[model samples]
Target chain A: MDLTTIVILALTGVLLLLSVIKDRRKTLAALRVAYKGFVRLLPSILAIILVVGLIIGFVPPKWIAQVIGKNSGALGVAIASLLGAVLFIPVIIAFPLARSMLDMGAGIMATAAFITTLTMVGFVFLPLEIKELGKRFAVARNALSFLAAVAIAVVIGVIIR
Target chain B: MNEKADAVANGKKRSMRERIRWDYTILFLLIPAFVALVVVFPDKGATARHVAWEYFKEMAMILPAVFIIMGLVSVWVEREFIVRFLGEGSGVKGVVLSFILGSIPMGPLYVAFPLAAVLLKKGAKVANIIIFLSAWACIKLPAELMEFQFLGWKFTLVRYLATLVVVVALSEVIGRVFFKQGYEVPDEALDGAEG
Candidate 1:
């Protein structure tokens, strides 16, 4: 496993250890809650995975690049951010796809915007987010996040270039 | 609402079988759709499985720990504590605390959703929770490291600083405009999944 996995595993182990030591009963209750909660959230989680698979399988990366790469100014940034907001591709995959775009003449700002929005604004998780945190909070966070992605891209563009 | 609380307190609530049927239905429908996609495009189907499998392995490894910690929050953490630390009057310290709480975890954004929900229920500020979710989503330490390795330090650092500034501003605007009245987690919305 990677560092993230190892670090989180260690932390969770310690927390579980402490809880068991301090109060076994409460810890058991906590485990029960964990179990029930996992079951409750399992469905949407799987749906997201399936959807991600489908998108990756169907939508060619070359096509996505052509949408943003075909332009270089505001239109490029806007298209990049919009695509980022909609796509559910994982960050690991996103990085390589981004590198390919850069090699093919995509601007740094557009790439930055795409990555930021893809990470920050998850359209795939909207239903789950809304269910857990309310419609207003979910909608507001996403809508603002879209704008923020472009703003950050502009800042980075100005600074880097 | 009181009865639900009582059910939780008693730890004897009935199985949430009915409430979860929608999820099962979605899963049922998705399986066939995916199968059809795979059958139509065999080569792309392999790529799809490869992408999904990588993430599935990551989820399988981390989710139990993440869920356990979430459960611990439900049982061990007090609502008053969340309020005092992350609520409206918490100031700059609240934002810092939210960032710390968010960055230390290792999971996809979706995993954080339930935790954020729990914190929201317990009285964390909407701004603070948004900050937490934002950090979890993008500014994660490992994520930045990955960026550095793939895109180089110059690109990584510039984008990192930019994202941090924008995340804070975005979260605050969302907080002020939408949750100015203090958003409440409606009881039925979080019905079966309090943990």
Candidate 2:
């Protein structure tokens, strides 16, 4: 791990210890709240994680490279955006994934869209979103993000394509 | 009037499942994650183990920190402070602040999600948090610097500019439309308007 991350981890540990030692009741309350939240979300998250595993199990990087790689145009941009709209992979994985896509010849525009939408949009998280934030906000945020993804992709496509 | 009423009635007739099936949020979130897993991680045993282990360690080390920080940020920070600094009325200043705050984020995107959730609960506007998290994931300062070393200044600048535009535009849209009734333009959000 990097120095920053290590530092943050150490701080977290210290804080947790302090919280536990100082106000055991509050600490326990917080732990309970956090655990309850985790339990509520667990089923859906686990299902999503399984689906993620399946995706990794099947699709090859070459296929992604073929669709969005260096020679791509409007179609490639659309495919990349669509792909992004459907996924919610962690940001940690996205960098190496994008790099590998680049290595396989994915165009910069497509890569940009893929990364942008991957984070912005939350298709599978909709249920959780609805449960947490309500339907209107969930719909609007996601819908706007989808359009924004396309617009961003096109803007990048124009500049780099 | 009849058509509108009919439309409302027709909509109400559908099951939550059916309505949810049409929810784009679910689909959009799933695809990129799916693509990442499919397109990124090696399928073979040894390579998969190496990649998984590395990522596992990184997440293992980072997640606890993320949870604690997120909790602290939520509990310690006041909603008014976040709104004044990054809320809608903060305008250009707010947007710039949000971008800077987002860009410096060091942990993973998932880490930001919980933080964003806490911020929302604490009264940070959805628009700002959306912009913050999205930008945090894409245009990380340290990560971008690393990329600059490999990808050149021109590419990085172009990407950064594009991302800024996208983040601002999308955040505004989300703020305007896609939120629940109670949270939509919360009364506290207007308190920052004059500032």
> What does candidate 2's lDDT look like per residue over B113-188, in tens digits?
5556666666667777777767776777677775566555766677778778877886776677654332643222
lDDT of 2 by residue, A1-161 (tens): 68768777787778778777877766665555444444444444444544554544455556666667755567777888888877666655666677777778777778877877887776855665554444665677677777777787777667764
Worst 10 residues of 1 chain A by lDDT: A36-45
Stretches of candidate 1 exceeding 4 Å from the true structure: B1-21, B188-195
Best by lDDT: 1
Give me the chain B TM-score of candidate 2: 0.66
Give lDDT tens digits, candidate 1, residues B89-181.
888999999988888747689878768877888889898998899888887776677788788899888887777778888788888887898
| CAPRI grade, predicted model 2 | incorrect
RMSD of candidates 1 onward, in order: 4.0, 8.4
TM-score of chain A of 1: 0.89
Q: After superposition, how far is residue B33 of candidate 2 from its true place, in Å?
A: 18
